[model samples]
Target: MTDSSVDYGAVFKALVAPLLVMTPDFVILAASDSYLKVMGRGQADLLGQDFFAVFPPNPNDPDAIEDYLRASLERVVATGERDFMAVQRYDLEATGRQGVFEDRYWSAINTPVLGPDGEVELIIHRVDEVTDLVQQLGRSGERGVTGARAELETMRTDVYVRARQLLDVNERLKQTTSALQEALDRQRRFVFDASHDLRNPITGLLTELEVALSEPDSDLHPVLRKSLRDAERLNDIVADLLELARLDTATPTTTEPVDLAHLVMDELERRTLTATVLTRLDKQVVVCASRIRLARLLGNLLANAERHTTTTIEIIVTTDPPNAVLEVIDDGPGIAPADRERVFERLFRLDDARRQDPGGSGLGLPIAREIAQAYGGHLYAADHSTGARFVLRLPFAA
Candidate 1:
C-alpha cells in the first residue's frame, strides 16, 4: 500500500499504549494516544523528531541504546524480524510535572512492518512498564537475603571466637541451628500460604463484582471501562498467588480410579491446541490419583506449552507396568540445562511470555510438581532437542 493511501497518523493513535512507530532512520512517525497520555508527550513535539534524542539511553545502563532498544530496532530494519526483551531497566525522560529522567524498567518487544517488496519499512516499538514489579522484587529480596546472611554470619563469628570454649556446646549449637533452619523454612512456607489463602477470597469477591458490573442492566456502564480494569488485574494476581500456596499445605486430595488416557483426551477435546497428537494408550490406562488434582496438573502443563510455543506439541503416554509415563514435548526454545531446576522454584518467572503474561501466576510448574509428589509420582523437565519436554510418572492402576 502507498503511504498516501493510509492515514498513518490516525491509525497509530488508536494503537496500544507505551507504543512508538518509528522509521528505519530513527524518525518518530506517530505516537499512540495511550503512550502520549502515559509519557506526558504531545503529538506535535514527538512527530518528525529523532527517537534517540527524544528518549535518550538510560544513564543507569550505559548500553541501553547500543545493545538494546536502538539495536533491536536496527535488527528489525535489517532482518525484518521481531525482537523481545524479557525485562530491561531502561530509563525514560520524565515529562510534564516530573520534568526529569526517571528510573524505569520495561518488558518490551520491537516488531517490523515490511513493505510490498518484503523489505522492512516501519518499526513498532511496544513496551509494558514493569518498574513496580522490579522494584518490589529487589526490595523484598534484599531484605530477606541480607537478614538471613547477617544472622548466619553472626552465628559463625560466635562459633569461631569461642571455638575452644564451645567444643562441648558445638553439638548443642549444631542442633539449635538445625532446628532454627527448619522453623524458618516452615515459617516462610506458612507466610506464603497465608497470604495466598487470604487473597483467594478477595479475588473471588472481585470476580463477582466484575461480573455484576458487566451486566447489561448495570447503571455503572457510563463510569468508563478503564476504571474497573485495575480491579480485574488485581483479581488475576490474587488467583495466581493462591495457586502456589496449595503446595505448601498438606491438604487432602480425594483419590479415585482415573483413566489417564481418557482424562487426557477429555482435556484435549475441551480446547483447541494446534498440535499433532499420536496417542499410544489405545487401551484405558487407569491411575490411582486425585482426578481433580491430576486434571489441574495436566492442564497447567498443556497451557504452559501453549504459552511458550506456537509450533507442534508432541504428546506421548504409555505404561511401564508399575508406573504410567506421560510426556508433553514442544518444539519451541527449550530451557537451559542450568535453569531447568530453578524453573520450578516458587514465584519463579522466566520471561515476558511466561511471568509477565497477565494470566500467568508463576505457580503452575511448582503446583504441578507438588501434586505429582503428593501422588507419589515425580514430575520433572527432561532434556529436549528442540524445545521443552515435561515428564510425569505415576503409579498405574489399569
Candidate 2:
C-alpha cells in the first residue's frame, strides 16, 4: 500500500472498536489503535509477537483463553460456518495511568473471517471496556444478604429489650399495691382491738359510780350523779366507736335466710321505751344475710329513731319481688337536703334543730350502712312528708 493509503488505514483503525487480526497459529497480524492502548503498549512493540507467548495459558485451569481460541477455530473449520461469540472477558496488561495491576475483564466478541477460497484467513477480535460492571456485580453479591441479616438481628434485640423493661415495671407496681393493701388492713385491725380493750374498764367504772350516786343522804350526790351520767354517755360513745372499728376490720362469713319482720319486733321489745313505737312488718319477708348482722342493723336503726324523735317512731317493713325494704320514719325535725349523704358517713351528725336531742354516738347510721353492704344490700335516707325516713334495701332470698 502507498504511504497515503497506510496513513488512511491507521486513521480508520483508531476510529473502530478495539480490533485485532490474528493468524491461524495464533500469531499477531495487526492491531488497531484502541487494542494497543488496552495492552499499554505501542504498535511497534506488538508486531509479529505470538499471541499465546504474550498471554500465557494457565495450565491448571483448562478453560483458558488459548483453549477457547483453539476450540473456536476447530469448530469453524469443521462445519464451514463462521464461529462467533456474543461477549466475553479478556485480561490485559496494566498501564501506568491505570493506577494498579489487576486482572481486567473486558467484554469482547471473536469471529473467524473467511477468504474467497473458503479457508479461514483470520480471526477478528472486538472488545469493550466493562471492568466497572464486573466489579460492581462482585461487590453486590458479597454484601447484599449479609447487610439484611444484620438489620433483622438488630430489630429483634430492640423488641426483646423493651419487653423486658415493661415486665419489670409491671412487677414493681404489683408489689407496691400489695404493700399498701396490707398497711390499710393492719391499721383497721389496730383500731378495732384498742377500742374493744377500753370498753370493759369504762363499763365497770360507770356501774360503781351509779351505785354511789343512788344514796339520797349524801351532800355532793347530785353533782356525782351528773358526772356519772356523763361518764355513761362517754361509755356509750366508746362502745359505738368500737363497733365501727370492728365492722371496718371484719370480712363477711356465711350467709343464710333471715326473718326481717321478727328482727325489728325483737329490737323494739328489747328497748321497752315508753315513747310510742309502731311497726308494720310483712310476715314472711326473708332475706339472704348473716342473722346476727341483720339484727344488729335493724336494732341500730330503731335505736337511732328512738333517740331522735320526740313522741312517735314508726317502722314499716315491705317486700317487692326482687328486694325487701325496711323504713324507719321518725317525726323529728327532718334532715337537710345537703346532709343526706353525709349522714351515712362515720361521726357525721346533722345540724338540724334536733341537734339538742340526746344519747346518740353519731356512728349508728354509718355502722348500719356497712352491715347492710356486707350482706349485699344498701341503706339511704329518703324525703318524708313531716319527718326523716331511713330506708334499708336488701336483695330477696332466691
Candidate 3:
C-alpha cells in the first residue's frame, strides 16, 4: 500500500506513542517516525526485513528474542488476542554500542485488517514502550530498601530500651518477694511462740479441773471441758497456719525416682472411701520429682475428693509413653463451668458447693496445682460422666 492511499497517515504520525504495522508473517510493512527513532533503526533498513531479525536477544541468553517473537505471533494468530508485555535487553549492532539493558514492558493491540470479502489481509500491530516508568520503579525500590534499613535500626534501639525497663521491673519484684517472705516468717514465729507459752497454762487448768470434778461439789467441770476443746481447736488452726507459711517459703529440692502409683494408693487407703482403685502403673513410671512434694500433690487431690463426695471416689493411675496421668473422679455435684477454673485459685471457694461443706481450707487444690507445675506437670478439671474429674499430667521419666 502507498503512503498516499492512507487518509490518516499524517494524523497517526503526529501521535506520541510508537505505532507499527506488520505482515502476518512479521514483515515490517510500515512504522511511525517515533518507532524508528526509539528502536534506533532506519525505515529503509526495517521495511522488508522480519521484525524479529532486527534486534538481538538479551546477553544473558542469545535466543530469547526469537522465542519472544514466535510466542507473540502464535498468541495473536491462534486467539486473535492482543495486549502482550515483555522486558527485553539487547545490543544495538548497528549503533556499535555496548548492550543497553532496556526493560520494554510493551502493550500491543493486534487488529486484523480486512479486504472487501471480509478476509483478514494483514495485522496492524500497535505498541507503547513503558521502559522509562519501569526504570523509575527500580530506583524507587532501591530507596525503599535504604529506608527500611533505617527503620529496622530504630526498632532495634526501641527493643533494647524496653529490655532494660523490664530488667528493672524484675529486680524490684524480687526485692518485694523477699520482704514479704520475711514478714510471713515473723508471723509464723509469733504463732509458734504463743502456742508454746499457752500450752503450760492450758495443761495446768485441765489438771485442776480434773481434780475438782473428782470432788462431789464440782458443777464447773462441764464448762472447763468445753473451754479445753476451744483451746485445742485454736491450737490446731495456729499450727496449720504455721505449716502453710513454711510450705510457702520452702525451696524445691532435687528430683528423684518416686513410686507415684504407690503414693496415690496409700493416700486412697488412708481415706477408705469404699471407692474402687484402678492402678495401671507402668512398672517403671519413674519420674524426676521430689517425693514429699509428689505425695502432697496426691494427698491433697484425694482428700479434696473425699471431703466433697459421701459415697465413692475412683482413682485411676496410668502412664503413657511420655506422660504420667493421674485421674481422680467423684460422684459429687460437678463444678459449674464458671467456678471450675476459679476453684483452683488460692482461698477461692465457690459459693455453691464448697460453701455448704465446712471442712475445706480452700488451699488444697491450689497447693496441688503448684506442686504439679514445680515438677513440670499440670492439673486441670475435665468433664466426667457423673462427677467432677481432676487430671494431673506429668512428664514421664527420661
Which candidate leads the pack in lDDT?
1
Q: What clash count goes with each model?
A: 0, 0, 0
lDDT of 2: 0.69
lDDT of the candidates, in the order given: 0.72, 0.69, 0.66
Q: TM-score: which candidate is best?
A: 2
lDDT of 3 by residue, 79-155 (tens): 45453433333324545455654434444455666569655566666666655554454444445655765565555
C-alpha RMSD values across all candidates: 22.9, 35.1, 24.7
Tens-digit lDDT string for candidate 2 (124-186): 666676666545544443455767545655554454345445544544564576588778886
> What's the TM-score of every candidate structure?
0.46, 0.49, 0.43
Q: List where candidate 3 sits over 4 angstroms from the true fold.
A: 1-247, 274-282
Answer with 1 or 3, whichever has the higher lDDT.
Answer: 1
Q: Looking at model 3, report the run of 10 residues with the lowest lDDT sum.
A: 83-92
